[model samples]
Target chain A: MSEAPAVRLVEVHKAYRRGAQRVPVLAGITFDIAAGEFLALMGPSGSGKSTLLNLIAGIDQADSGDVIVAGENLARLPERLLADWRATHVGFIFQFYNLMPVLTAYENVQLPLLLTDLPRRERRAHVEHALSLVGLADRMSHYPNELSGGQQQRVAIARALITDPPLIVADEPTGDLDRESAADVLHMMQALNRELGKTIIMVTHDQRAADHAHSIMRLDKGVLWSNPDDAAAVQPAGQG
Target chain B: MRAVPLAYSLRNLWTRRLTTVLTAGGMALVVFVFAAVLMLDQGLKDTLVATGAVDNAVLIRRGSGTEIQSGIERAQIGIVEAQPQVALGAGGTALASREVVVLIGLAKRGAPDSVANVVVRGVGAVGLSLRPQLRITEGREFRPGSDEIIVAHNIRRRFEGADLGQTLSFGGRSWRIVGLFDAGGSGFDSEVWGDADQFMQAFRRNGYSALVVKLNDPEAFDAFLLGIESDPRLTVEAKREPVFYADQSQAMSTFLTVLGLALSIIFSVGAVIGAMITMYAAVAARVGEIGTLRALGFRAGGVLLAFLLESLLLSLVGAAVGLAAASLLQTYTVSTMNFQSFSELAFGFRLTTAIVLKTLAFSLVMGLAGGLLPALRAARMNIVEALRAA
Candidate 1:
């Protein structure tokens, strides 16, 4: 523990209710994701993979546990202050690559920095650099609808990294791309982790997508199994 | 408070042009009615105020609100004229005019039997000197103590027998319309002028309705008023001419304002409901975007402010359009009945700078009121559910 873990979840528990019946999604899940580690989470549907990612990203609160990220305990933070913390500490990439349809790629990449005190000219420079990192510099002015599915995901990646947060959590980053486009997106993400020293947590059902990460874990019935072999075995073949 | 870029709100409004236009159109109609009401009241006040002078004073019987309802007897007239504060003419005569105001039924030019009450004032010798604006635009002034009459342009144009060179028969006597005069297109343009003695003799009356006097030193008005009102021999009230004229229009103008305000309140209810519905639809349609914004670290307050800004923008567009439509009324001249005197009064539609500012402020209130709950709904959205919606 020379360098503290980027994310530490201690005995986190969460549940949902469907028509008066309580359904537990995560139960006492404990783990530490070291700084600069790129980890992939593998799980079946409804196995709390996405819920655990949300907890780490500060998008949702754990029912009862210490869900901490980047030295900040999100469980104790108010929603208002947690938003500021997330803006400075974590970047979120959704499964669908949720870029605002009305805003162009450049504007979308600049979204996170808008919450910061960065001057407009500095914001422009940061947006340009982030888009260039994602290989989307030429597509800066193109809106989401004008771009291909893979290009839109690249824009989403640029948006996630523009803040230069210590942690990036992506939920199914390439679940909807072609094999070649998925490879390109995964390579870009690996570059972000290796070159920039970013800690990444990815959730996916695709084995090839998970193979790009440095470490792997699986979630089953609200419990975490950290064996990389168990994670690899859960992945079905012929899937990206 | 940190705000979303105004462009975001502007672009959202542009994206849903149809709803924006429809909601803003309803607001425009409400603001139009509101502005027009204020203009109508302002126009009425202007017309009446223009007929009076700052240095002149009008005397009416105590407890009478207007000249039409007041009577100053022949004896009281001498007492009022003998006051030393009255200005003098070159002939050493006092600049005082004994006036009688009476309402008579007069037919319009086209419809002879459909009559409306018109104001006809009888003036003593110095009447023409006191009103510098009144001019004999067409013919000679009326000779005092004769059956001769001079008609104002509005009365001559709108009434049948009040025309030049015609005789108007009323009170069992016939009066010759000798001249047509103009009173600078003021409230007096709706009145007819004739000899006070002849008018009183024909109507079997001996008292003047009011006395109009010019003060030698305008600063001596208080002393003059005191001299006239405090006399034991006279039961009269005196007011500076402009003040008296403003008082005359107060009741009528207030009624117009109240009536317009009530209607605007009713229409604003509909406009507010329309704006609320439009905002609710905007929130419902952008559920995914809302969640995306939340995930991007935007606080709920930012989301709330963005929606409210959009609503405010919609209402402002409506306000501009409404004010533009109301401005067209400036070219129109309208007539309504004066409640105090029961006579037809004509005035034009008017607008002022203060009125424009007030109208815009009113629209902002409506925007804030209508957008509150819908914006709160958007801000309170659970991020997980919203992202899952689309």
Candidate 2:
């Protein structure tokens, strides 16, 4: 692992405006994740975990403070440049899998590579290899609607990894899956982190899902606790 | 920056097949009206323009706009026939046709109670030879100095008592139809033809209505026109036959063009609105998909282009459908009163490559007008809010 952290948040804060009302989601907080570390973020609904993940993934801007991922300060990057930065530096996995319904598994996995100047033959080879990594070599031609929830999530995983981005941000990746499917997706994610040496940040409310990560962090009411024991003590009841 | 794949837009339209078809159908109806109108105008212009040969010149009274309203004295015809520019026919005679054009009211074929004016043209001996396109398609040619006549194919099909072997009561006489001739889809197809002397005796006309003369060299038309017009003894003007016929069609063609354009404008408004609604619905339905694309590093411009492309494809489909339907109109003939000549002229729709290009450009404009706002909305969506929508 590199000595420098893969993701660093310096007193980051975020809030959204609903009509005339301002709703703060993330308070000014600082944190870092070492290169190649697999970290899980757990919180109740509306605890800003997803917001933090989104900020780290460069999909959302911080209202104040700096968010540095893969050594680039996201708050300083222009909107157009941020998209390009995300394309080559960050991968995202969403709760519902977010595969284009019209595309087959292979096409969905190959979507990100369309941004590159890669030859068509090379793109095909890369897409096949990514689908294979997710153990979906035979299912490449199946659409999202035709696949099980687990298989769709695997397709999403392949999509996120296709560009070989340094950092992966997954938001409740297994939330919509059955128990077996959830386990299967979690195992694949773990394999990606361990075997490929990918830096991962996952947001989930399920403690078992969080346990698969190397360490866990919890957010509550726009505040974060890095200590696992302290986080468990302050954890709200009935929040998985 | 990379664009959203064209396949993405295509597949999305296919996925919403019902919406796509309904929107495209509306556009198709508008394009049909637009294309049909242009074709009607083109058909009218083509029929009249094709009536006169480039080498032929028509001489009528100084201010007469059409042959029906003109009178050429016998002395004037004799002078025109003697011109050196006139072409020599068989037996070394100048190819000049002293024609009489008159209108007779006839009952329409299917509507017996409705009557329309038809042109009855009396031509000299060499008149059929002057118009090379005129061919006897059925029955034999009318004998000279007889009451027999040859009805044009269009006239024969459209009017009662115009068929071969039938007799038409007109000009205080009953004229027998001895032949059916096809004028190759020219304006002459709307006229009945017979011997000029016979028609003059029956109609009690003292002079010819017009004189059609074939020029020895088509390129010498300017000199020939100047000589005829400058003659103090002749109160007549000369026009290239094609130009004269083209002028005859101007009023009716303009009327058709205006009417067609007005209808297309009115119908296109509805189609544009239909397209806008369809695009808006598509944007609403794919809010999550748009956000997913944005999150996957696709720029706002790419999303906008994708939606625009989808709308263009829908309109292109509609244009094709409308053009196909309009092209079928060429197979059938229609008759309408020419405002200039006040005679019923039959013509069929004519489609050209220019019309196809115009239809496509029109449909694409409709698509762009309808799709722009919705596409902008999709492209400008907040990524976080859109992701939450999923």
Q: Where's the lowest-lDDT run of ten residues in candidate 1 chain B?
A: B1-10
Residue B270's lDDT within candidate 1 is 96
Error of 2 at B335 (Å): 0.7
lDDT of 2 by residue, A115-167 (tens): 89899999999999999999999999999999988999999999999999989
lDDT for each candidate structure = 0.88, 0.91
- What proportion of the real contacts between chains A and B does each prediction keep? 0.52, 0.70
Clashing pairs in 2: none
Encode model 1's per-residue lDDT on B55-135: one tens digit a residue: 899999999999999998989988888899998888888789999899989888899888999888999898888888889
iRMSD for each candidate structure, in the order shown: 1.2, 0.7
Q: Which stretches of candidate 1 lie over 4 Å from their true place?
A: A227-240, B133-140, B161-167, B173-185
For A1-240, candidate 1 gives per-residue lDDT tens digits of 288878888889999989999999998887788899899998899999999998999889988989888898999999999888888888878778998877889988888898999999999999999999888899999989999989999999999999999999999989889999899999999999999999999999998999999877888888876563643432211210
